[model samples]
Target: MKQHITRFRLRSVSAVAALLFAAHTAWAVDPFTVRDIRVEGLQRVEPGTIFASLPFRIGDTYNDEKGSGAIRSLFALGLFKDVRLEVSGDVLTVIVEERPTVADVDFAGTKEFDKDTLKKAMRDVGLTEGRPFDKALADRAEQELKRQYINRSLYGAEVVTTVTPIERNRVNLTFTVSEGEPAKIKDIRIVGNSAFSESTLKGLFDLDTGGWLSWYTKSDRYSRAKLNADLETLRSYYLARGYLEFRVDSTQVAISPNKQDITITVNVTEGQRYVVSGVKLEGNYLGRDDEFKSLVKIRPGEPYNADQVAETTKAFTDYFSNFGFAFARVEAVPEVDRANNRVAFVLQADPARRAYVRRIMVSGNNRTRDEVIRREFRQFESSWYDGDKIKLSRDRVDRLGYFSEVNIDTQDVPGSPDQVDLVINVTEKPTGSLQVGAGFSSAEKIALTFGIKQENVFGSGNYLGLDINTSKYNRAIVLSTTNPYFTQDGISRTIDVYHRSTRPYQDQGGDYRLLTSGASMRFGVPFSETDTVFFGAGGERTEIKPGTNIPGAYLKYAEQVGYVTYSLPLTIGWSRDSRDSALVPNRGRYQRFNSELGVAGDARYVRGNYQFQQYVPLNKKFTLSFNTELGAGKGLGGRPFPIFKNFYSGGLGSVRGFDQGTLGPRDVTGSSIGGTKKFTLNTELTAPFPGAGNDRTLRLFAFVDVGNVFGENQPIRAGEMRVSTGVGLSWISPVGPLRLAFAQPVRKFAGDRIQKLQFQIGTSF
Candidate 1:
């Protein structure tokens, strides 16, 4: 009986201990239905937002797991700095400390960037007005400002952030930035290089030590990006010279204690010179090995050239892409023979799959119409992918003068390996301009010009312009418009109405005038992508006003054909322009041929002019251009060409050495009497402004000009042509395009007039 009692007691104790454990577990994770939910400490955020973020709702089971998840969801909103949950009975309460809102953002002592720009930058990083503000974000903003200064080589720049608490639980951030003087490269040294001289290697770098033009070029500025670019150039130089194992081991940029000067050191290892032992193909060549082999630029028994290898591979890839292989891959693998100091290149090509363009998409053209860009594309939707056609289409769009940037991206369909989409993205630029210009010349004194021009009028891909000029010598009023897609067959229509009165600027033919008023309509038919043919007709009424100092040519015309004359002129022209840039051309050719016939008028004559220009890039910094123009006019039937139609040379647009319109034959009063035949040739070498880096808006050029005008009976003679040589500056300033030249006549006659300096502002030639 005693043993049974003790066993019963032990069993009772075990049962009590197990019950306690179960009760503790139940208290820890007991699920209860939420009877009420309430949020506290909400200023800007809505209560509904908090309720939406909660993982548990009223009447939902609430446990430790759900409570933790609810806290996490609330914190992830990034609107609260502190979040806490409390439970009383079946009610759950959430308490949050909302982040301080940014009331305002301002900058002080920031001359490099404007306040609006800096604010925009901050806004981009989620630190804008009315947004959540915190120390972490403010710290990031400070770092971003520092980074911008560093990019400008401002090593000593300092930024201080001041957070001022304002009303309504908001804070205003003030970034006080002090941009220090940019660190200039005082010295650049290359060590451990033996194959090339230090000076020779240094010439390959775009960055350099301080020079006379350093202030403008900023090449002396110490920038991490520029240093990396220079290092890559050095690598390319060595690699292209057959240094197969060349490498830039280390580069050290040290700044002075004052942070105003910097020194760069580059250490390199050029292992050995290599020769190309052989070249071979290792993959399928679309069953045209010979054709593919012909594209290889690498030659056996020649020094190994990395450029050649890259070119050969790129050529293979492009060739494959031309044949509908949109995802082609071509890689050149080199097998090095260390003992022989030679390498063999094996080109591997993979034509992954044939694909066609499923659709051509255009985007980012906010102002321009979709059809305007589509019309320029040579590659159509559903066509086989052709790399050449795609490139041409991109170029055509770039030449439209409507966009600042044009890019083409090919996207492959997820489920269709044989289908792709071409996305043409364009960044639109301002195509309209209102120009008001005033320029002074020695002869014309001061000339004022005003014009309003719109190349893409209202996104319709049309052109409209109105010009008014008030100059003593030349005055004009004109209106013009063009429809680029007149007939939808790529033919353009242009209409122009103009009235002008001309008098000699230098001779001041006091009150004497040749008035010309006319209207014309023209159509430009595209013969090819780069060629166009234009034909038009117009009627002109010319009047010779008699007065003191009248030009002898005009007097003679008035005596023969009366003071007033009318003519119906027919015009036809052809032009081909493939220049890389319309404003600052650096390559390609521009050729034009234009002719005018006075078929039914008081004056019967035919006039024709031909001009050609070619630009060749000599190097990264220099461009060589050549221009030639020829014009001739003759009487038709038995009548002489109108004196008003005479060609005038010797000006900024012609021969720059002599006075404006003062070249060729002269009358008794020593006034220029322009002739019917004209020819001119201009050659120029253009380069970026000293210290201007790669800015093409400002440039300097040295030119050689030769031209002369001849009478109807005079013969064309090289000896009779005037020659000039000078240096000039071309600047595309905010006002307009300006050109200034100081020319010296190299060849001239005793009767020739000289004007050494000439300039034109707000003009296009």
Candidate 2:
């Protein structure tokens, strides 16, 4: 019985011990304070990095809350894929598996884009190399690649990206792009263009079907910008005519299945054409009704010219604006009588509240100072805004040549409807030019020249020029300056000092040169909106260099010619041009009449020249221009004709079929003869280059020139004139204007024939 009780007690004790062990196992988790955290399966990450990511520190409790937070933070860093926390006794360990970093990015078969450009595009979307690799970024890069291709008209381009994992926890990305064919213009059709023929209307579009000159003009390429510009041209063409209500309804651009061909269709609405019956003005004319009425160019019983109407409205507004009416309005109310198909315009003017300018701000001049541009303004701060003066200021700034572009913008002052601030923006260009040229002519066999000129000296809009020419026929040194506005009231001033020597146009056994040195000052004052009067006086000294070439008559008068003479000249001129470029005037009228009277000089004379040039557009393929110049020189006070002022005509500027300065009367040895009076008439029919399409920069022209020089008192006769007609090619090059003409003499006298081919550089028409 004793043995049984002992065994039972031992069994009970054993069972109790077993129960205690099970309880401990269920209740006791290893109490741990995170001593450190370690990361595994990482080639680029450090152990301390993993520890730094833990939320609980070495002596802190590591429970599910802290452990879970540590793991969540590690995963949020995007540097790991797997994260876990383990506790052993009083130590905790944090483990993480790091993601791969991008090693390098490359492009394959990408000829359309540069490597750096693709890299920049990818970088914009977080796909740059050395950043963590993500599948989303790679997909975005592919889309961006395709978008860039579309901008270049490669609509069918394809892009693919590949991510390759390499050793050392790094990845490499590759973008493969296939740039398909470029979209080309297959057809461009215009509808509802009845006023102009289809061929004529189609010629206005810059984007066109493939032509032989497509390589140069690139007109066969489809571009959205080009289509929009073509629409504007169409509108302008119609408005310039009588169609004032023309509109572009829609434009459709369709691409083919292959995405290599495109078709464009333009739909327009043609409106009724109207003629002007009469134009009447109703406004507060400021007691100058008659003066304002004369400014109206829209006459009675004439075609309704949109240009004329706009001009009339502008004139009225300008007059009011000049009187401090900053907010002026001029409306052209057209009264149409359909029965007679005539329109009468009543120009209604309203001069809204008048106010002075608060301030003038200058902008867009990155290289120029504010004062440089502000000085050109005619309308000052705290002064009334004059539209006419403002327009004149803009023109003055444009003529400076320092600015590539000049514009004036008016902004209304906040809370003041009648007040405005003017802002002048100018873009600066290279203002200094160095010109060096060498030419060979019959008169000046080998001539070399150099010129240094600055149109806008230091952005001041003042001119300084120095020119030197050395040749067998002539030599000169000139220093000149011009201030477009010397006075505050828009008066211009010019100063010149020059020394010139000219060899007489003679073939006889005589050498004659004239040495002339002079200083002149001219002041230009506005006489009207389109006219200016220039008056000046200067002193000149002429020293006749005696040589064997001197004519007998000139030598007889040379004894009294070597004297310092004081002379005054007065000139009045008018100009009105609406061409986009002054150097190559296309459609404009230029007229001028200049008269110079030599008062109180050794040789008294009066010289006058009247010139008129008109440009007419016959069709899309042709532009006809005509120029006429009539000049007369009369001796005053019983003085003989000045031999130094004789006129010589020929060469590229006059008759191309003749030599330079060799077209007039000649000596017995076939040399040029100079005269005192001249007359010339020139006409040209300009066309596009054969294979150059309608490139405005290159043109071909057929011209006819008729002119001659006569004695001072001789009668003008058509029989005594020389006529030449020829075909010429011209180009506006970066170096300047270049021309080459192949001419034939239609009518020639003895010793009048010259080289059939003539070429010139730096010449403008």
Candidate 3:
């Protein structure tokens, strides 16, 4: 029994012994004055640490109480595993066996997490290098590591800790892990649901049984967080469909004994559906009762919908906020009649108090400058709070494309009733990227392209980029920069310098090229909140090189305008974009118009182009989009239209199923020289990719393309357009937007080059 008790007491045996000694000394050994002190058995710890914690020092009176207190205090320090106190002729001696220091911490068989990450986690739990090592602490760390693996669905993962004592009382620790297969969700059952079928209800959840794309979507993995999110989605689905008293009563998750499969069962109660009988408002409206009533979205004749009620209350609160009431409260109180299965909504509003902003605070911007974000805000400090301006300010910051998240919060001032502070919280993201591409070929063998761009250079809210391409067919180097805030009023300025040497057309084998160099500056003026107008001018020289396989049209142009031609091109453009996303837009409209003129050059021409795009969402998974473009050019001062300035259309971007830039009139050598007038139309219907739930980055699109480039004198006629219809895939990849099309021409003339399949990156129609 004594041995059993000793084992059970474990590390506390020393404390128990010290207490017994103190009792004996009080009874038999009398207290003595300590004249000197000495410490022993310490390896790495300082002596002062022990001296400072002692209850009685040198020349001080010692007693049983002080002896007991000293033992307790030293034990609490955690640096020593054993401590003892002795008194010999008024000279006290302290002995301590110090705990071994942790010289190193390591892990084995970890694939899912980085070693440094695990070390940091161990450090948080008081187990790390340079710290005292204890068996209890190592056991706690082992448990924590197992918990981390369990969170990743590895239920069978095992962690074993190994400790090796080295020289100088230092120990090394290693956590060897055996990570097993992940637990997949084998079954998901929704019970107590009758209004909707089991399949329909399950369809709303992101987690499910195994599917073809399970590996990519990971929807079959059992995650507590994902389960909770799915449960919320299920609740919302029923709430939106007029289930007034619906709720989830219980959820149960079970894992198989092998730890490779999981089963989930959810019990829910779907209450009676109700229809709205009437809607009323019952609160202060600040003398704008009519306007406040207009914000109501509830329809008396329709079914009761929680979404409409939430929208109405949110609108009411925003309306009150617009009048400087920062602490406004609005709610929709539902009156349900069980007998008739009907409900009525009463909107209650309270405009608490009017307040103005005392100061504006910004945070979470580790790299971006404060001025970069402040200039985007329209709501100023020491002014009345306006919801419209605040919302606009958030949108503007988001549109900067430099931040991943932008948020604003209103905080009340302390001891002040009519003042508040606006806090702007921003999360920064990588605002720069470098892309390099290389390939091997014969003519353009060893092709390489290196491009780099920084949208927020040094946190100054400026854009800088460099593009370099080296290939036999096309080679160019360009530098560009933009200052978003050139002046105090938000006008932007951009500069561009480029030198190019390339064969812009595919004519079998061509050592021929066009050498061009130029520089330009542009200024953009914001015409409105959604529109911007730009105007710029530049001077460039175009030199045609004579080589084997060169086109006859180029030779003719060179003879007429000499081998070298210089032009000062004047440009103006305007754009209006309201799209929700630039890469994948589901609902919005975009319009742009640009025109250029070669005013003082041997090659005198005026060119204009216009584009219009509209996207309409037909349903949750389908979108209908249309694109239209038109171009026209004319010669000035009786000079013929410059052959170098032409529009080419075909292949992936326009009129797929035809060769790229091969739809226009061909020269005598059977080579495409392009055309001066062009028109194209694209109609597409996009849908969700199969087995990939809720991933908008990948999608399937069926498009019909119709367009053709016309000669300088040819009229732009719809009947002459080449048309094709096909299906394709679009993915927003890390490199860029990738598009692959498989098309077949529906309307085509003989001698038209046919290319049934095409692939491209960063081309949009």
Candidate 4:
């Protein structure tokens, strides 16, 4: 009975174990179906975001592989820090900890860069205010800030970032930067240089020791770009002086242990000096071999001059381009014989194709219209390219004074071997000004002057000017207009109207005033690129007012003629101006001759004036200029000297150290005298400041001036003229040219001299 009961209990236990094991296997193997998905610990992310991120959806089979993929997808959004997946029966749950959103960004102790610039820099690295904050991005922002500071030579700068959590699942970031002392160049050294002195080479660098202007130009700051430029300058200097194989082998910049001092070392290799032994030309002559030969400026047996070689090559290329060979290539192949230290050049020319201008485009002229620039071009579209005409067109644009920069570019047309396009770019600048000022002198206590002028009206290259001056000694009004291009052939037209009054200079003597009004029209015909001939005609009326203190000679003339007048006059003039600047010439010549012949007038008269000026640049820093003027006037038809035609000299524009219009013939009361003939000479030497950079705008000048006035009856004598010597400063400021001078009368007649110091504003010497 015991055995049978034990066997039944064992069978019951086995059945219960089998049922439990079967139930466990069924629960594990049954396919899990998700009825809904729940997300928790999400503040910034929406519930739909997690649903969209899940790999498994409702009614889909849920497996371990799909659940792991869902967690990874949620984390990949970068908006969540922690993601988890849970399963309960047929329901799936997703939990996510969203990253904190950036609330605000703050910077502390930032003077090197503006707030906006820093914000931009931060945003570029994904650390903006509204984006989700991350540790890696914040660290990257800190590193970028430090790098920027280092670029500015602040090698000792420090940057720290702080992240603070705020309400509404947001955080604030603050970047604290400490900009330390900037590294300075303690010394610079050159190695393997024997052709030139180290000091001479150092002088060519724009990066130098600190100077007064270093704060503005920041030349004391070190930069890789500046170093490269300095290296190029060094190479150019050597190559220009016959050093054919000059090169900078390597450059090294060393910083001190304290990060406060830097030393630059440049290793250069200066090879043998080369002398030209011979030159040969091989190219199509275009039936002008003699002309091409004449264009070769590089001479054999002279030191190899890179400039002359380049000029010869360019001349050959230009000659070809003028004949529609736009793709011509002229290569100057130098054959160097190292043993003999001699070089030979072969000018090889290739005329690839004869190309025509397919299109003419104008750009970069924001203010000037396209038509204005196109009208000035000598080269036209749909025509054979002419390099000479294109160069001339560029020069004309440069001379307009309305553009600061001008350039021309050419591009080949696609699929068209014989076609090219030309583009012209220009940068426009202000060309109009209004001036109102007053001048003080012993003769004229205060002379008020007003003037308005526009060199380029509406970017049309036309000129208009109005001038008015009122003073006790002189008064005048003038209106003038000039059209630089009145015709397609480069002829200009000018119209002028003027009313002028002049008072005779007298010291407590007789006073005299004359009034004259006239209008003139002139036509300027181009004789050459740099020369012009002008013809004009005008009519004028003159009335003379006699004063009580007239000279005895003048009184006799005044009794004979109460007033003198002229009805009409004709004028002819020729001018050539090739100077770089009209006010202060640097390198060129200016010549002008004008003559007025009486046609039909009450007081028949003839007057002529001739002026010549030349400027020669002695070197990069020194220039010498010479000026000469001659004037003559004669009264015809038995008329006494027309008092209005007399000449007076003094002051800044003439012989300095004397009052204006006070250096000529004087009345009985020791007033200034007027003459019918005038002669003057002026010379100046200009030099740049020592130790300054290659800025030619500021300079010092030494000058000598000699001038005098003589009557028609009197002969011109060199002894009668007054002379002055002086020194002056010239600056090309943004406002205009400013000049200040101090002069001493070297040849002063008794009781005729005034102050020794003379100065003028808005004038150039």
lDDT per residue as tens, model 1, 1-765: 888665434322121233343235433445689999988899999999999988878989987666666667877888888776666667777878998899889899988777887787787778888889889999999988888788888989999999999888899989998898888888899998998999988877778886677776688888888889889888988888899899989989899999999999999998999999999998889999999999999989988888898889889988998899989998899999999999998898889999999999999998899999999888989899999899999998888889999999999899998999999999999999997878776556688889999999999899999999888788999999999889979899999999999875446456878899999999999998779999999999999888887767777777777899899999999999888877788999999999999999897899999999999999777999999999999988888788878888986888987898888877777778788999999999998887666668789999999999999999989989999999999999776688888899999999788899888875434
lDDT of 2 by residue, 26-136 (tens): 333344565654444667777667768777676786655455466667777777766654444454545556778899999998887899998898899888777877776
RMSD of each candidate relative to the true structure: 6.8, 11.2, 4.7, 10.2
True-structure lDDT of candidate 4 = 0.80
List model 4 lDDT by residue over 1-765, tens digit each: 888665434322121233344235332324578787776687767788888887778989876556556766777888977776545556666666788999999999889899899899988888897798889989899999998887788888898888889899999999898888888777789899998999999888877766675565566677778889999889888887888888899999998999888899999999999999998888776777888889998788887888898899899989999999988998999999999999999988887899999998988887776777887788989999999988988888788788888898989999999999998888888889998987764456688999999998887878999999997767999999999789977788999999998766555644667788989899999888788899888888777666666555555665666466666888899999888888657799889999887768675678899999899999766899988888899987887656666777777767776766678776565766578898888888998644345556667889898998887878999988899898877777665676667788899888775766665555544
| Model 1 worst lDDT window (10 residues) | 10-19
Each candidate: what lDDT?
0.86, 0.75, 0.87, 0.80
Model 1 residue 570 CA deviation (Å) reads 1.6
Model 2 RMSD vs true structure: 11.2
**Who is ahead in TM-score, 2 or 4?**
4
- The TM-score that candidate 3 achieves is 0.91
| Model 4: CA > 4 A from native | 1-188, 210-229, 252-264, 283-290, 435-450, 468-477, 487-489, 499-518, 539-567, 598-603, 657-661
* Model 3 residue-pair collision total: 0
Better of 3 and 4 by TM-score: 3
Off by over 4 Å in 1: 1-32, 63-68, 82-95, 299-302, 337-342, 441-444, 687-698, 762-765
**Cα lDDT for residue 355, model 3?**
87
